[model samples]
Target: MTDVPSSDIAFTPRVKALQAQRGSRSAYARMEERGGFRTAVTPELAAFLAEVDTAFLATANAKGQPYAQHRGGPAGFIRVVDEHTLGFADFSGNRQYVTTGNLQENERAFLFLIDYAHRRRVKLWGRARVVQDPDLVARLMPEGYEARPEQAILFTVEAWDINCPQHIPRKVDAAAAAAALARLEAERDRLAEENAALRARLGER
Candidate 1:
């Protein structure tokens, strides 16, 4: 067997110079000098987020490694309990418990809600905590629905920012929101037909 040659890779002179220009110390100093940063969510953003049924929940571990999961519920699932408070249900999942585990380590989290049909997006940053009180869950549960076995996670909003839809591409068919469900039905039909054909061939054998 031939031996592979070893190679050394290093930053170019220009890259090294650029890196030195903004070291971690300088970056941290600049951030510290900013005092506090806050952005209010516009009325339009609040309305859009209220209308959407899904959002992407992003959380990070103590080391700042981020994980994102898609969360969905009925329309108006996300509730703006107050001007600075937002809450949503935490349904069951694969049980990886990444978000819940991360929140235990680091309460800071972020959420992004996008209405593809409406061409809008909202970003929310806040501190989150996993709440596990039966009475509280009972109060929050929708009428006629049982409480999920998994506990819910609540997020207390610290700041939120609204992005304009000017940059979002226009949607061609807003009514096609049910296309995915239709595709699933079609796939089920196709599988059934294939199964029936296989059964017929087996009988012929």
Candidate 2:
């Protein structure tokens, strides 16, 4: 496999240098020619993102200090504004504001969306800015969720890459599991009622 990612990838000089020292530069260069590196979101990717309710957002300040935060909501909380743009409603949380502050100094951001049950994940690199437009924020908000939308974050696509499922432990979404349980209970109740109806019909006969 090539060790050098595609040119669209946000691989910095420092990362390339490390790759050289680690003897992965040539492998990456060969690997760069293949894979789902894209400058815009594809239809399959949009559908994948719609199912992801959680992702890890990484940001760095002007001084290069890094901060990572977990963002989540109901499924499809992240909105695909276009093939090249993504938007999401930023909700109120612990008043830390690290992500907000970092974006101010440095717009560079990276996102990791993982489907643990399927052991699949996607990596997105872009520039992000927070906006307070009421109309846009409302459009991005997840329906039926109680979180208070504070603002909206728009991420301009630079590049994106899909990662292999290696090392990812198989896990299930809690909400999906709960929904499955509800369906099973409904099925059980329906069968019970049918049995009772048959017993009553036999007694009368």
Candidate 3:
């Protein structure tokens, strides 16, 4: 959680204006017609999506200020439905809902998927819509799992691109995944204990 100064990291007006002008054209020719940028997703992109368990989602506000949030789930959280479509399960968070709020104002978003275990990364760009259809959510959920009614957001991906792995280092560990899960459970238990103590002290007042 490092705070990035709004001034230092802000997008230039030219870039912001270009994004606004691009709007929502899908085809490269149509995007070119509107002076928008375009990129193609490759097989490498699909492989990275399958391996990565977390991603950083970036969006902007009405004033063109950008925000980035790290989102995580079990491996395969982001599913590639096809060459152009991607799906993911969005769960409850700190409740600020900044990403959702930004999407409402501007559907444009960028997703960064990094597979640290393999030191690989990919970038996905698209428009997202929050969906609440039970059937759709159910279909997206892994086998033997049910969607939590209150904590799901469906992202309809429009375009994506894969980056070259030249900068990424190679590394892998079989135990790393299990160790991470155990650490999370331990932290949750510690937090619950502290919360109970705080509640007990309040009752004594």
Candidate 4:
């Protein structure tokens, strides 16, 4: 994009050095100039996040013991609060509270979101906070999900990166399969009605 390295929203010292050594620094720098990676989310990014039903959250305690946890819900469980903020309701589960504990010890976290059917993924670096506000919990709730909300986990995004679909295997969403079935049934019904109408006209003839 630009002639020189423009920004490093998610790049650390180790990352930049490695990219330089591998001769990819310039390419990455150009990408940055094009806003391929950014510290703030865009409206398009918000909509993408809202439609995903699952994400993996990575966190670490103050001791640096890392933990990876899966968060899921009906589609649209995650809400984009602002360009820089997104969050979801913490549902009642095993009560292990590993994530909650780690967030208390260290707010730093990362979210990995994937869309298997589209073979797309996005990673976000952020700080998470546990919220107890009732209004917020209610606001983030999905329309017909039965999960009990414990607390709201709010992520304040620092930087985000999107990945190419190179190695991601294409898969299908269950809902997509169901939608296909419905379409097939509707087509079949329309054909059957047309056939019946033709038969009646031929009988009259």
Candidate 5:
């Protein structure tokens, strides 16, 4: 029996078999030899999380029933607590609590983060826990955001990998696009005034 590589937390024997069948195992094997997915947050990953205002969190119950929940707030809402941990304030929503219930039964979780404007995505596998401490929740909460914090969820990352930007359609944030349009309008007005002055000067000449 071939021992599993320590850095390869994502690929199981079944997954490897499929890769081999598809003729892609050798490339992955080379990757494994270098070192598989990253287990700790690097500088690049930390910067990416800073601009991520949205994420999808996936969890499963003890019975293996899976659920994915959408989480969103201002940029930097998902804060990196440390090299191995991530945290965010759990805002009150519809009170369904499906994610909370699943976590109680199963700690294993996955975080999917995508930056539409940049056409980049990241996948992280981790274990998560919910904290009801008011102090911790307050610390993670974003100021000036109109949302009531119900609690906090802390995730300890096990392994993570970034995917290529292929097939990711580029999109811009609504607020950012609006700001850019405003700047262009202002510049157009200024140029219109300059053109009128130049016309008057030519007439005088």
Candidate 6:
């Protein structure tokens, strides 16, 4: 049996075999020697997550059927509960309960977070639990957001890694872009007013 590092939780024997066949095993072995992926949230990760407004939660049933669901809120919707834990308020959506049901059967889950504006992405492997406690759900809910909290999802991160921004299409947040345009228009108006005032003063001279 091959010994897998704690941080390399996703690298099973079959995966290692494929990597070896493809000539990538040596590089991954080097990574394992260097402690593999991160098992706890670093300050950089926390900051990155703080600005994440969108994420995808993926889960599988006991029979290995996979499902992915989109989760979005204002920035900082996903809260860093601790070094290895993340919590978020599960907003009342279509009420399908697919994710909740999958979690019950299979705790293993994954989180995919992408910052389209920065062209960065993060992958998280973990176990997830659905919490129906109102106090906990309320604590994770973002203030001033017009979403009803139905429950809370807590993820215990086992391993996490970041990917290079190779093919990610750059995209800015709509709200942020609109605010920038508004500021630019206001500045343009102010400059036009100042220029007109200077011209009037010169005419008076």
| Candidate number with greatest lDDT | 6
Q: Give the TM-score of candidate 4.
A: 0.87
**Candidate 5 residue spans exceeding 4 A from truth:** 1-7
Clashing pairs in 5: none
Q: What does the lDDT come to for candidate 5?
A: 0.93
Measured on C-alpha atoms, candidate 4 has an lDDT of 0.87
lDDT values, one for every candidate: 0.69, 0.88, 0.66, 0.87, 0.93, 0.95
Determine which window of 10 residues in candidate 2 has minimal summed lDDT: 1-10
| CA RMSD per model (angstroms) | 15.5, 3.5, 16.1, 2.9, 2.1, 1.9
Which residue window of length 10 is worst by lDDT in model 6?
1-10
| Per-residue lDDT of model 3, residues 30-134, tens digit only | 434543322444576666666676789889988898999997666777777665667766666577989888988988887888776666776666767677766
Q: Which of the two candidates, 4 or 6, achieves a greater TM-score against the reference?
A: 6
Worst 10 residues of 5 by lDDT: 1-10
Decoy 3 TM-score against native: 0.58
- TM-score of each prediction: 0.60, 0.83, 0.58, 0.87, 0.95, 0.96
Return the lDDT, model 3, position 72: 69
lDDT of 2 by residue, 129-188 (tens): 999899999999998899999999999887787889999999988778999999999999
Give the TM-score (vs. native) of candidate 5.
Answer: 0.95
| lDDT: the better of candidates 1 and 3 | 1
Q: Residue 108 in candidate 2 has what lDDT?
A: 95
RMSD of candidate 1 to true structure, Å: 15.5
Per-residue CA lDDT of model 1 for 59-175, tens digit only, reads 999999999989876656776656666766676778899999999999988888887677877777778888887665555454554436367667776656556788788664434
The TM-score measured for candidate 2 stands at 0.83
Q: Give the alpha carbon lDDT tens digit for every residue of 100-168 in model 6.
A: 999999999999999999999999999999999999998999999999999999999998999999999
Evaluated with TM-score, which candidate comes out highest? Answer: 6
